[model samples]
Target: MANALSFTFIHVLCLLLHCSASSAQNVVFQPSFLTIHGPSMTALLYGFSSKITLNLQAIPSSNVTGSFVPPSCVPGVTQWILTSELIAKTAVQVKLRLNRSLRLCGNNETDTDCCVKPLCVLETLQLTACEGNTSQASLIIQVKIYALLGSGNMVFDNSTIIQNQVYRPLGDCPCDLTFNTCDLWCCCDKDCSTADFKLFRYRCLTGPFGGQFPDPEYQCSVQSTQNSPDWFPFLCVTSPPENNPYLGLFYQGNTMAPKPGISFGGSVSLAPALSNAYTEGSPILTIKDQYFTIPQTLNGHCVTNAPVAFLKNLDVRCVTSVQACPTEFPLQTIPEDLRAVVKNGIAVFVGNVVVDVTDQLATELNEFVTSSDIFGSSGLVCENVTLALDYNFHWKENGITGITLTRTVGSVTLKGNVSLTTRYSAMFLSGDIMSEPNSGNPGYQVGRPVIGGILNTSIGNDTVLIARSPMHLWKPVNSGICSSADVRPLLFGENSTSGCLIPVSRQNLTECSLLRNSVHSLQGALIEATLVARNGHPDALTLADWLNITYVTLNSSGVEDSNSSCADIPSHLHIYLWTLVSGFVDGIPQKDIKAVQISYSLSSWRLKCGGGDSAVCMDPAETQLLPITSSVTFIDIPLNTGPPKTRYQINFTEYDCNRNDVCWPELAFPITRFYTGESYSQALAKGLILVFFFIVASVLGNPWRQIRQIWNTI
Candidate 1:
């Protein structure tokens, strides 16, 4: 029994030792050398092992290849805590780095290969290893492995690859999927579905090699419809040429046909002919079918084409001459001695002789002469003379009343007393007048004449006597009788009165005076004629007699003294005597004759002073003669023979000199009065009292209210 038991114990001991050695020998290759089974050949490995802990080493002589350090085993757990260097190397070793923390977990004698619960063991380990010593050599991969507590074959299913999965072709290499060939979701097999194919197609289409397409409507061109044989066609192109001949052609076409109305059928064959014709005043184009004519004359030439239309019609006439056409012919031929006479717009004979017109008279003599006969007589008398009669004069015997007598050369005298009494009539004679023998009537008298009447006498050297017995005489109520003489007085002699006569003279005469009122109620006046002293002789007649006068009225208004009147003053007073010196006898200079003196009677009481009880007597004889100067001072006098000089003196004297008691000699004559009783202080006091009362009244009276009330009342 002993010998059998000993043998059993030895067998058990051997078995335990062998199992332990086998456990130690189960070291894993870091990556199970993967062989891809389909279209591609590359593979990868990942994991860790215990017996063969990877001691990553630097390649032989490269300094950049770092030295290797092995992983450590935990004392109690059947897991491994990889050193950061080893896991970091594995994580960084792949072409694309893996984002995972690797762990190893399984049963061993100690925690040699397996990792704890949350930590994963790398099934495939990839490490970058250098080939040789040189930095120029390519890098080679070094992998490590670890075993698991499983009876089946250990598979390296990378949890990092499974968790972060992507759609990659199973058998294709990662490098083969490039931007040039495929999109990010490229598949190896061609049996992809429509959706998957579209996805890949989109990726490929958007890839680098797929170029851009052209726009759909490009390369079009536009053509204009306005085309002709003369006009080139215009094209509007999508892309215009840099040096486009067609563009030039398009502008040329526009020049040919600028607007729609242009046509091109005409030819230029007759151009030279047309030019030649135009030069020859026969243009091919004509306006209104008329040949235009160039003007032959410039300014200052009378136009033969005054009516413009007449120039085209060629039918106008020209003015030949101008002549006078008289209306009424003279009745008879004037005598050869008679001066030239124009009668009824006709020029008669040009000499001095009388022509008898008894046969040519339009009225019977019948103790009268007609206007035509009288005009004929005037026509026989003067040269260049005209005569006209009123339209009422008839061609019969009754119209013979108005007759005219004219004398041009010899002195003509009226031998009979002529009387004219007619309405609308005139008696004109330019000769002498004389009373008829044994005829009581005076020369040329008229009575009670009416409208449109005149009696004009222009005598050379003659006297006219108008009798006063025909009380109406030459005095008509409304009509006028003017008599002018160049020599003797236009006289109003005995029996002639109350008529006007004007005498004109060329010779100076002594004692020349125009007499009037020689008979009763006769008045005569002369104007614009001078009465001179002849041979330095004074007028012989008194001035009052020289100018007829009767009575003078002074102070008719009774405001001035009636004793200022004088009787029989000159009717025609000379302005120089009345205004300055009387007939130059006073010898007073015009400048010194400033004022005139006159006296008026005054009562003694009127000039007295004081009240009625104690009045002082002031006699009229005591009134002073005070001369008051005018404010207007004389500057100079203009003399005919010498230079002008100021020649007058002026002084003032007060009229009421005796009123004031001051007796200031410098005060001249006028004495002014002053208030005697009141002092300035007293006046000021009174003013203040009035002012105070006024202020109180204004304040109490409510003046603004009163004003408003008054305004409202209106």
Candidate 2:
């Protein structure tokens, strides 16, 4: 009876499977909701056939409907419970394959391996329950999925310029670009037009990789397409060549004195300090004049505002006799001490750096560290490392102390306009890192440049003097200085050479504070030109990509331009000024700039034709200035010059600032307040009317009484 019932149940389940196919639409394995953290998960390298397997399992839920549960004869028929329960009832897990791996990155190597390692990035799953196999009563759906961040394709140029990193093409990184052409979201001009393109071909997120310039700007589509979801509200940050950027400890260079003084045989005195420099803490050392607290500690970052690398201070003390130590010492800044070189026996220090290579180091411990032929372990490469770091050092005695780091907290990433990796591991610091001096070991006195490294095991009592490389950081040069808020039409007059607006002179820019303030105010305005019919044309050089193109540097500040004709004046003044007027409308509660209407007046001119005193006249005083709207740029430019054209005299007029024989219409706008003395005839007429009224009153004899009697008789 049991065998027959089992066969009947199997047959019945098979029949039900055929009758009830899934009614829901084909579901995407990955959904739109996860793109926030999706970039990190989906970073895909092109040409690698990476695949991940997905397994779906159902959980029991009471709210689910549309059951496909089999009869009691089946052994395990619990999975086919519902259809409406999309997320609450079903769960999906992805198994990472081949080269694809998950990284739990953190502050140091030790923590990275243990920080937050999720078993799998959870995905919301929806499954069709109708097609449960007969024997496997508990439904288990397995599907083969491609390994990618999205359908968006990525291109890899095998040029070795960007080294020691992987490039996982992510469509959505961080939005740091403001230029339309550079805007990844814009579909119109981004040149990422998806017109009949195949499955593997994606458009450029930005213009040509190296730079963008000289032609039509990036065509950013206002609306997103089927594949390219409009990801916006991001900054236009410059893109780095490598992906999953991280920094490793390069070298702990040297410890600066607390102040500009050092210890001699037994006494401490003052010394010369570098100008425009500040002090951070120093590392522990075993110099004769120095002694340290049992556990000297300091914490700081590689770059000024970088992530902090808390250092449990190395304990360096002196057993040598006759060394009295001072309580406190001053410190020196990072860049100030990084360039010191070691020649004979004097110890010179380099800049300090702290990185969180925890996960990467932990995953490939042996692979990450190689046996060092020199002092410290080797193998980690610093091919294209870019860093900006700042840290603090704590000290007790002169020997050495603890360290603290500070910067924007995230991962220690190597990126952008200020990154340069050097082959030199490190240079010798001020004093040897050795715990005790070896009289015979010459290696302690002088050694080759040493890059920072992580030992798989802890360094014993011996101090490994890690060498510091020359850290190179770069700041973008100002091509042109533009003060947009104060931009106005050039005032061309007897004091000017060109009959247009006069640019602030180079001498005034250097000496005058007012000009500098004005220039600084108008920061990022675009320069445009009005149509003119000048037969003599200017130079035709383009300035779209100022970095790539040969630019004629103006004698003025940073605003570099292509126009050779306007070379004499400041390039910044040559650009347009966008005024920023910050105000509020009455009765409106203003929070953001959007919540209120800001009214701003620009320099305007209407030919004032001679007119009568009428309310309909277009008067300048009564005119209402325009209100701020959609444009983020808000400005209030001043109107200094009197008019576009002003008449010197009557019909015989002089054109002071008129262009192309065009004279503006004059206005009798100022209405005359007082009336001129009345004519003699008008005064006589008023006098006669007064006499006639008096004569009529005399004839009526008591006019008031006679008028009252006449009204009574009537």
**Distance (Å) between predicted and true CA of 711, model 2?**
69
What overall lDDT, based on C-alpha atoms, would model 1 receive against the true structure? Answer: 0.24
Model number with the top lDDT = 2
Q: Rate the local accuracy (lDDT) of all candidates.
A: 0.24, 0.25
Tens-digit lDDT track of model 1 for 402-509: 112232112111112211111111121112221111110111111111001111235334432211111022332212212321111221112222333322111101
lDDT of 2 by residue, 615-688 (tens): 22333233211111111222234435455542444334543223326444422112222223565566556657
Q: Model 1, which residues run further than 4 Å from truth? A: 1-383, 387-472, 475-714
Model 1 RMSD in angstroms: 67.5
> lDDT, candidate 2, residue 320?
13
